[model samples]
Target chain A: MRSVRYTPPLWRQWNLVWNFAQRDLKSKFKGSALGWAWSLIVPLATLGIYTVVFSFIFRAEPPDLGNGRDGVFVLFLFAGLTAWTFLASSINGGISGLIGTGALLKKIYFPPYAPVLGAVVAVGVQSLIELGLFLSVLLVLGNVGWSWLLVPVWAAVFTTFTVSLAVIFAVLNVTMRDLAHLVTIALQLLFYATPIIYPLTLVPEHWHSVPLRVLIEWTPFSQFIQVFRGLTYGLDAGSWMSWLTMVAWAALALGIAALVVRRRGGDLGEEL
Target chain B: MSEPAIRVEDLSKVFRLHTERRSSLKEIVVRGRSRRAGSFQALEGVSFEVPRGTTVGLIGHNGSGKSTLLKILAGVYRPTSGGVVVDGRVSALLELGAGFHGELTGRENIYLNGSILGMSRREIESSIQEIIAFAGIGEFIDSPVKVYSSGMYVRLGFAIAVTLDPEILIVDEIIAVGDEEFQRKCFDHLFRLRNQGTTIVLVTHSMGLAAELCDTAVWLDHGHVRAIGPAPEVISEYLGAVNENEALSNDEPGMIRAGLDAVRSGSGEVQVRAVEALDQLGRPLPVVLTNEPLTLRVHFDVKVPVRDVTIGIGFIHENGTGIGGSNTREHGVPIQLEPGVGYIDYTTDRLDLMPANWRMSTAVRSHGHVYDMLEKAFPLPVRSSGGSTEGGAVRIHGRWGAAVQEDSPSTAPSAATP
Candidate 1:
């Protein structure tokens, strides 16, 4: 068998990513006190914190029309957490992924982007677990919708978007150690600036608000929530614009990340 | 007749060294940002080809580009200005345990390291048992590698590598590590590999080892090919060069000349009337193993000197470092002086040595210093091996301690009378 490191065809990039992804997923619980359960626990704790902050401190109540179901609000929050956490963790760790596996980079003659790909894949697995938790909550709360059928599409788009973004960060992290913090904080600001927890309808409508509204919709997290809300709450995507923007962002991120990895891959060892 | 298994042409690699360290802000400013684009030239125009089943040993001093050349051939590092064509599957044990994850279980790491060495996942799975058995890690294979000692580390790495069965194998200095038993096992594996018609490239500093194992050898000096030929011939030239370089600093010119003349005439049963170290100008003096253009001059009035009396200097090492001396008698230098005053000067090009104390011995006889025994001196401090021999080549004049290890010593004091 011929050993490879993307020297053959570009299609092997996916295989390289998958191989490294397995390594990353294996490392997550490889040495933990609770093993794989840690993935489920952190999100459970985070959900509890948000519930206390939003439900008790603010005493925030969802809009009701003589109905005793606040499941919509809960699903909204859960969906946001799922999308945000996956992208944030993957993107944040992706930058330093090479630095973390510095020894491997110098010793092994494989694709340099493997570590970062592995990290994102690990986060993808975590997101799936989180989705399981989210589903159970939806089932218990008794506010379910037929729109859940579209959830997989939304998740796929967002997951792919997150992975592409992570690839870019992993390459950048090789040269800039601080980029890990920079990307995480940038992603955090994105979460607040988007409509993850907030409803878009709450904003005052204005024609001159076109650019602002478009920018908000273009965010992958927002795009995910938009379609997710559409599926769960009987909300329909008003235009095809959100889908185009999400796809365009993913393509662009992937393109640039691939180029960077291809050109300066050999430098990863030196940087590490 | 067939195409060589591995070929390299004009291979050269230049590393841009970044030696300055600045972890803290204060230190960064104190050291100032600096980078020197110094080229190490780990391999320069090093052209060679190895037919199938040929074992070629690379002998060189440290930093002579042996490792770099091996890395490039292993495909771990891309050559800076040349190309290589390898015709078969390659497994390079550049470093053992390089790809193992300490946090992973030893069994898991076996698969991981194997894949890194170009073993497929299926291949690794199939070979896992053999790897464990060969490593002798036993049930500890289930334990995380963080708990492993260095011996275990080498065992696992080597075990995984040996299972790969690559058609072409490139070995760095890995055989120098581990216990002697493990080293012997490695040799057995290499021997089997060669018998199976696998081509191997070995980089080592031991000339004797190369001569024994390699079909041919190459001498690398600072990234350039100094010589390449038969294993024994090339290795002897390298050893001679290494000694001459070391001898240059601590020896004199005249004594080396006289010794050379004495050896040239050939000798038998020669006795020294006078022995002196010489300056670079061939003047007699009292130092041994000095710098370039120097020698050891032995002036002797023979009582019963015969035909072809051999006189030569033999430097003795107590622990892997050379002490200085030369006599025609020991080195097969043939000469005969019938009850006449005569002198022999042994000449050398240079003295490549580090600082250390050692023993020097000189002897003289007939027929290349092998026929009859004569005078020999205690070794004095001549040069250091500079720790380059640390886990490396065996020093000729070195001493070795030995003991018959007891399996279980009888305990008398702790035993109470029955």
Candidate 2:
């Protein structure tokens, strides 16, 4: 009999993870006539609608680029939306990961996190592609800067952070199905609460003596968007405090995710 | 020598049956605390060891925990309170195509499924050709599996599982699917694996298959181990208990009426009581040896006087294919019946049947009108003295001879004259 380990190390299961991720990516556009072009088209369409609503309708002022040129409001919104879309889709996919692959889990023995991580990686790849297209648009607009080198570094950190959150929510969603619904509502609220659509300058320093600016600045989504806009839109590496905050958030979420998985993952097969 | 391949100690699994299944927060809040639902133990203190290089079969009725035990062994389910130590790598075929995606092509699925089974990418790449050849689905390997027939799906699943060459293989009634030829191929592959000393654990309803393949059999009944011993002995004990339960059920008034109306239909004159296979010395034989004289005796209770009665018997293969049959009228034998109980014997000089499981079907008719008919009323197990190399339902008896022939019409007469 083959010995089974309930939680195999991620490095050992890399191939399996890659296979799952590939399957997910392929099936996303499998039979469609547009194929992978749809990956680009869907986000472009979303960016177009958001730009029209916030830039033209709301008359939001655009931030200045590091090249000392007037930043296009569409470019400013695209930078923030890229990071926001990655976070939203990764968490959503993670929430459904275990429930969707319940049939496979009941038949075979592998680490429960493989599918969850695979889903995160699949979305991560799409987000990277979207980032690439956004950078190309910056290149065409002559808004490039040296700080853009840190974009890959920030993306890696953001992915690790996303993975940790995905794992925690995936494991939790297995026991309480209402978690998914709650998460969907929470994400919709968080989108507006963060600086994805509106400029951070619009809000006062304090609302009812609450110090609302500091509160919004520390929200993980806001911190991520701040660093993303600094790299591609503002063309600066942002502040060390923001970088430290991103790393700390990733580390904290990872610790909680590990604890959640260790406690609840063993009996997942029975629950399924 | 070395330790057994698998050692399961006092394994138990209890499933909590949630009556209301309050997975929503609204229900939890409205109902206060989530009430503890009733729990049913699927497997209780089940202990067994499968020796290295030997096969063990789990046999039981549905919901008897055979499947639960297999899953626990496969590591798909963890035992509640017991420890299961497996010595080597394990591959379980709990369900064919368990991880298959409908949108993926057959080749893509193999890569994904193989990796899920713990094969490295290189290992799957190395054996991809062999798996495709074994499935025999031709160019359909490139087509998405959703479009393939169910047989093709099962074939590909079985192919990938068997080719993995794990130290211990776990299977659950997977061979029951597919055509006969494919089933034979699967058996041949399993036989080879057993010969190569791969420890195997199988769950199957076919006692004949269990007897043929397993070294030992474990019989489970209602979360308890009823018997564990040599394959044949344990199977016979299980079958005996099943027959007893059936007889007990038949005694119920409702079941008796239903049985008379469904399984038995005839005129209200003669009613068949029982069917038995007996040895030449007139003793009830549960298993008959090949080429031995045997008799099928049919007992009947005559409710009214009858004449020109014909008692017939038919041998049906376990697959429901009819082997052959005969009636007293076909042999020019006539019988007169009156009230009271009696039995008619259909005796044969030699039973020329290969080693396989068969069923006996009997009927009584008079004046071309049915009297009592019982289809597949009794099981007949034929065992060869030793393993036979032949296939199919019946054994053919003939002599092998050779004759040298010359290239001349007159001289080749001996070769042509059989």
C-alpha lDDT of residue B85 in model 1: 85
| Residue B166 miss distance in model 1 (angstroms) | 1.0
In model 2, pairs of residues that clash are A1-B88, A2-B88, A2-B89, A2-B90
* Each model's total of backbone clashes: 81, 4
Q: For candidate 2, give the lDDT.
A: 0.84
lDDT of 1 at A209: 54
Candidate 1 lDDT over B231-310, as tens digits, reads 87787678667656656764542232222223322244354544466656776533444334445566666666467655
Each model's chain A TM-score? 0.81, 0.96
* Candidate 1 lDDT by residue in tens digits, A178-256: 5676666787788887776666654445557566665676666777666665554433443478777777777787788
What lDDT does candidate 1 reach at residue B144?
Answer: 83
TM-score of each: 0.73, 0.85
Point out where model 2 deviates above 4 Å.
A1-3, B252-320, B329-418
